[model samples]
Target chain A: MNEKLDITLTVNGRSHALGVEPRRNLADALRDDLGLTGTHVGCEHGVCGACTVLMDGRPVRSCLTFACQAEGAAIETVEGLADGDRLHPLQQKFWELHGLQCGFCTPGMLMLAAGALRENPDMDDEEIREVMSSNLCRCTGYQNILRAVRAAADVMRAEGAQG
Target chain B: MKPASFSYHKPGSVSAALALLAQFGEEGKIIAGGQSLVPSMNFRLARPETLIDINHIAEIQGVSDQGDHLEIGAVTRHATFHHPVSPCPLGRMLTKVVANIAHYPIRQRGTFGGSLSHADPASEWCLVAVTMGAEMEIHGPAGARRVPAAQFFRGTFTTAVGRDELLARIRLPKLPEGWGTGFYEFSRRKGDFALAMALAALKVEGGTIRAARLGLGAVGAHPQRLEALEAELTGQPATPQTFAAIGARAQTMVTPSGDIHGSAEYRRELAATVIARALTRAAEDAA
Candidate 1:
């Protein structure tokens, strides 16, 4: 049943050509094949949102998306969130605001938020909570996740205003 | 869970996709957005030998003004409706109703046409299409044919779309001037499917309801329009009492089957409550 296709995945500003089966979802392709383990797989069937990632600048459930379907699309995961040793505003705020206690859902939450805030940079705290509710967080009760995303949005907005 | 192995075919255009569908027929399943189909595939509920991925088909994407109606391409994702796609009241309805269609990520990839084709009883888009009297334009080897929403949706997880045909685009009638829309749903969780949902569009003039459209979803096998109630609304005074009266009647109109979410009687109550809420919102805009 495994008919492998040689596909090029453009992820995190890098391209990786790998021969993967048609059954390989984007989450498994990233974690097992490409060694980008930041994406967590939970509920594997699109719920839980632990495998959320950006496909062409929009957040989508990587667990529900086949790897071959993602060819030529730009993918963003938690691995691409930071700039070198300097943490991204979102990552920094998550740290300062205590966004994670379990850390398993962190990568998915960060990527989901990063994609959401990019789409609507001026989202207020209430709007942030609405969008951030896409991913489930069992720890910290989601108040801190909402706080982190809101704070990061402010920083991003200020930086955006300067330029 | 992983999906079963299948031969993948990415068609660059609608014609190519149709050709693939015609060739594979029942064996080839069209994959657009893959929000619902892939998950069912993951559970092994659907195991197609050939998967025709329509993501690459650029011709069937985006929403466009088709003069009398808005033509939404089959591959138009739910996220596309987050903003008003038109200046008409229909645009407002789309934006208001889209947020309830699962979470942000699922909406980003879930296509409107795919939702209609999937025909999930709880789908927001399905309710919208049925309420709006939308027309579906399907493409097949024979030619293109149009199916109205009333006839398009057959049952739960079923539709009029043929095995060799593709729903290329959806045509939603541009609502008349002075119409206001309302949508309300009761879901247990933020992104879960609704237990009961209602949508209404009302046009009020001179304190009288001129035209109205009403629909209920998730409480039954398929989304249903309260056509008799819609007729009853015309010439009636635009008042909350009148809306509540119709809402009360609507509760008995739909035969909502029971599920794990709620009992049949519970859904009947929910249906009535949601109808009242939706009608109230529509009237707020009409006011």
Candidate 2:
């Protein structure tokens, strides 16, 4: 048997230091060990974005990454998008647009879209679709998801100008 | 499924990493970003006993402009190449193709060297490196040696990197003025694996073709340069008709295998379409 490894990670502004096996993935660590189950695990093979999370502010498939690989890295899961029960603009837009159906892919979709909006605040519909195409949501045909991103972009821009 | 058990080491320096590789021999696998290797391990496709993680090795980190060539570190993330502050048009082209790879999440963890070392023929970085005449530097106990892209890739998921060697950096020659470039790929869906892809770089001088480099992917064991079509285009008049004629000639140069997404005949037709579209885009970029 292999020895347990020491890992330190910061998720949603909190630090965690734990002993993990060498084979444990970041998604498993988030859901099983850390009890941050907002980041789902659909296809452990990376084909599904249900395991997406933000590593140092950039979206990455947590299922395909080893927990030790993220040591000293800052992470953000779906649970980090809220501020004391107040939802993010993207979360509100997703709720208003009915962007989710079965809700299995929502956590990953929200994280991916939030990262895209941060990188490009003025992305159009076609651009949003092209960027979000990497994240697969079987229930929603993706039309409403595209609309939600567009609507959220306006809300984020307005909030930015006001501040 | 969980990955097989393995020992992990993250060395802080390149020399220490190379020393670790030399000590571990065939039991070691160097991991850059773990975008490809981690999934393979999880699926039990690859079972290396020891993983030499090189992500913390600072020597192989960023892009450097060296006047005649751009020296890109092996560990440079795909996101860095896509940023607006990148120096070359090739960086912008890479950014566009990288965005279409898997998704933003995968790109954030995928390193330039990881893609090259993975050696997937359908991968964007492999095709672009072969087309642009990039050079790879490998370090071992004997020190560093440079291998040209033309001689680097051995076959599907295979490279010339030896067991004791580590890919250090990739050097890409800067594009000369008046050079046009294009990259086109046809896939069943956007962000899916490519069925067929083509890359073209042409240097047109005063309406005449001074030089041309054409590369085709997903049609062979390794991405290949179309030397026959390149020879035919040199010194010829640059025109839409000439490009179409060359595209037809290029169709015969490669024989792609039949797969689930596309038939062999369909892929042949797509080769022509991709090449023609790439040439037109390249010409427009040059103009």
Candidate 3:
């Protein structure tokens, strides 16, 4: 009943060409079509940022964006944060700071914080909290999550200065 | 929830998009940022037969300076206002207002035109458009025409732009030199729907108000300019006492309905409070 269109989406440095229905959102395609299930769907609306991913280095709600509309766009999901064995600084900080309780909103939080940290490496605690406010976390009460983002930002800034 | 089945058409140019809109008429819906429309589609509230994706039309993207006025393309992202594509007076006002939107991620995708065309009374863009006296550039079968922001918004989720016409761009005139402006909104949470909002701009000279533009949002079916209050402010002394009196008088000037957010009486009270704060801040900025 739905028309299918061809699209090529580059996610986490890997390009995948697939066909999706016109109504298929980018979040569903990233999870169902590609097997990268890190991107979660909470509200399925733009209000909640659970399905957020980096598009061209900027955070965007994948649930609201159509997969076909994302053709030729560079996307980054939670799965892209870690290497084979070494975890990204954000993941390490989250683990150390106890940023996750149920871990449902972690993927989206990590992706958004990654984008935020990249844009503002010297971001303060208030800035980190402000950016993470969109993604809802029922478990952590957001205190630890803010700490994790702040710690990760410091590490990222130091690494950037060195390299 | 997933949106219903629909045919998607991605047009490369404005003419091609207009052609499809004319062909489909009411059966088609243009998708720009998709931040608002996609969610509505998922809820089955808005189900158009044809989804015309206009993300690739480069002609209606980015900012252009028109000497006296700055023309902002409809597809320009809200995040672009944070550090504007180009610096202008409008950016200073937009940065304050855009932060009140959903979040950083949503701001990255939501477009200036999409929000204006949506015409949500609570939207920051709609309120500011009315405050700035923006002119909307529309394109259709008959070619192009400009509609003032005052006339562009007809009602809640309604605009003067026809189904066959597209809101291509919006032109915001540069505020007079030394003009000070303020935008304030009250939402339950940081990104929630606003209950009451106000935008104020003041151009004061020799301790007297030369021009005062004030607008209110989320207090009615559409955002409206406070013409009576604005007239009262003009030629008046730029003093906090005068602004406070005008703000208190503004409560009686609006007609707002009660909803889940707050009571009608409560919103009226807030209208006075926000308007007063906005006016005082704008006056301070002018000095």
Candidate 4:
């Protein structure tokens, strides 16, 4: 018998009150309990970074973070990135620049870049490459991922400046 | 894979956390960032019955400058240092070193005090702490005790912290105005554990090396200061030849074991090269 924690996670501007066991990871809670399967889990260990998500505006591995640990945290998954049907700037750039082949690592890459660019909107190509190196992508060879993130960063900056 | 079932306690204060840690003894663990611990737990390597999560303890969550030193709280996130924490040159050095620790997201969650407590030989924080002469403040059932970083690390993944004790804070001495610090590391990938790394702090005055501190990591079981090289550097000119000469002696000082990543002889060679590079950078950057 394990203890179940009654916790509330604010995901994608929606509040989800979940009673989860202490051992249940945040990725599982988001996918199974909340029915948000966009957050993929490639490696339960924190290596692949496939389950990356934004907790309080900082990117973190959902697989390593326990659901209980994320209590009261503002969780932002891939499902939260789009404004209705229209794609976010990062997603648009990834699609136009051919950032993915298998799409297994696309969600994590997008979230990681979103979090990083939000904090630093004026990153150069080298800096974008360095940040993109955090996640693994077997199919697209990473060049396209870096190009997509850098291009999206420019677009996001332009949109913010216009606003 | 998930962590084995355990009772999780989120303590608001250091004393409360220490109390729970004391009560659980060997069956307990303090989960900081869980960047390293959670991975091991998922692999079924660590099965603690009780988890003391100190993330909510605001008391142990930031760094404070104490004129000559910095008192970094135990749970202070590594992201806090992304921007310089102190005006001292040590802050710049720490920023440079922190960049090499894993990747972006891991740094956002990891902590300086957690890295010191983990005491991985390849850990850049451990190398910096041991090099800078950091003092660790630990709380336990008996009270609190301060342990120097030199004596704090026992071996790979082992430290001076006892079963009932918890690392509360780390006090690192700030480098003076004229000193320059340098760090160099080699790893297989962008965010892997360093195979060989060197950290050097140098103070040059009037074309002569007045002070020097050198530390090497991941070449052996524990990170340690190169006192012999430090002594050799002092009183010598700040030149590439001098640094290279001292670097060659690093292979003789350390007895590293061979692993799949590198042979013992290869690590010894890497140690010398990185040490030389770090020293050269330090000399070039020193004001």
Per-residue lDDT for A1-163 in model 2, tens only? 3898988889999999988987889999999999999999988988789888988888889998889889888899999998879998888999999999998999999999888788788888878887788788999898888898889899999999999
Q: After superposition, how far is residue A151 of candidate 2 from its true place, in Å?
A: 1.1
Tens digits of per-residue lDDT, candidate 3, A1-163, equal 5757888999999999999998899999999999999999989987768898999999888999989888888999998899878999999999999999899999999999999877778777777778999889999999999988888888888888899
TM-score of 1: 0.98
- Better-scoring candidate (TM-score), 1 or 3: 1
Model 1 C-alpha lDDT versus the unseen true structure = 0.91
Model 1 per-residue lDDT tens digits across residues B1-287 = 78778999999998999888878888999999999999999999999999999987888899999888999999999999999999899988999999899989999999999999999999999999999999999998889999999999898899999888999999999887789899999999888999999999999998898999999999888999899999999999988899888989998788888878899999999998999899989988877
| Maximum-lDDT candidate | 1
Q: Judge the docking of candidate 4 as incorrect, acceptable, medium or high.
A: high
| Better-scoring candidate (DockQ), 2 or 4 | 4
**CA lDDT scores, all candidates in order:** 0.91, 0.86, 0.88, 0.90
In model 4 chain B, which range of ten residues has the least summed lDDT? Answer: B110-119
True contacts kept of each: 0.89, 0.80, 0.85, 0.83
DockQ, in order, for the candidates?
A: 0.84, 0.78, 0.83, 0.82
lDDT of 3 by residue, B111-153 (tens): 9999999988899899988888899999999999989999998
Segments of candidate 3 deviating more than 4 angstroms = B84-88
Candidate 1: CAPRI quality band: high
Instruction: Order candidates by DockQ, high to low.
Output: 1, 3, 4, 2
Interface RMSD of candidate 3? 1.1
Tens-digit lDDT string for candidate 1 (A1-163): 5779999999999999999999899999999999999999999888889999999999999999999989989999999989999899999999999999989999989998899888989888778888888888888899988889889999999989998
Q: What is model 4's DockQ versus the real complex?
A: 0.82
Q: Order the candidates by TM-score, highest first — what do you get?
A: 4, 1, 3, 2
